[model samples]
Target: MIGARVRQFRTARGLTMSELADRAGVAKSYLSAIERDLQTNPSIQFIEKIANVLDVDINALLKDEAATNSSDETAALDEEWQKLIAEAMESGVSKEEFKDFLEYNKWKLKQK
Candidate 1:
């Protein structure tokens, strides 16, 4: 579950394992295991360490495999983004505007 979540979050952020490992100050191989579920029973502290570096709550990475793991907060964030994008579309915002928005947000995140 955590592996899937890690892979999902990493991919969503457009980061490779090595990139994330560098950001998180962890081993790429270890991160790989975390993504593959081969290391299923990683400790809570281990999970917390990774979560802290990722800027995601540990609970987001600790769901049952059978469940889809978007917490209410994450879902709310997504809904807000969707609404903004939809409003932009209705207002005829150009693709350039969207690209700029995404790039700006990504850059802002990097500043953290």
Candidate 2:
């Protein structure tokens, strides 16, 4: 699933196998194998190379959907965040205000 997600993100970026290989400094054939799931267990270094090439977080490459939040939970969070953002926009909050809100939220979470 992680392999599939990485390939999806990579393709969405319009990167060919060889193009990504060049950007990641990895071999094209190994990258192909990784995409095809022929090699189920790629090393962390290899995964990091691919993630960097994709301009994505390494956590994105390593995510296990089964162990993470369910689609329903994520959807709920998305809906809530969207509502908050809409409200913020309607309130004419500046970008700086939004940045401050995000920072405050991060601090609040850390305290938790």
Q: Best by lDDT, which number?
A: 2
Measured with C-alpha atoms, the lDDT of residue 14 in candidate 2 is: 62
Give the lDDT of residue 17 in candidate 1. Answer: 88
In Å, residue 91's CA in model 2 sits off its true spot by: 31
Q: Candidate 1 overall Cα lDDT vs. reference? A: 0.74
Clashing pairs in 1: none
Give the Cα lDDT of each candidate.
0.74, 0.76
- Candidate 2 lDDT (Cα, whole model)? 0.76
What is the C-alpha lDDT profile of model 2 across 20-85, one tens digit per residue?
Answer: 899999988988888898888999999888888776788877885435666777845744664565
Candidate 2, TM-score vs. the true structure? 0.57
Q: How close is each model in CA RMSD to the real structure?
A: 11.0, 8.5
Model 1 Cα lDDT, one tens digit per residue, 1-112: 7898787666655567888888877789988998898888887877877787655788778875334545767765754664565466657898898899889999999999
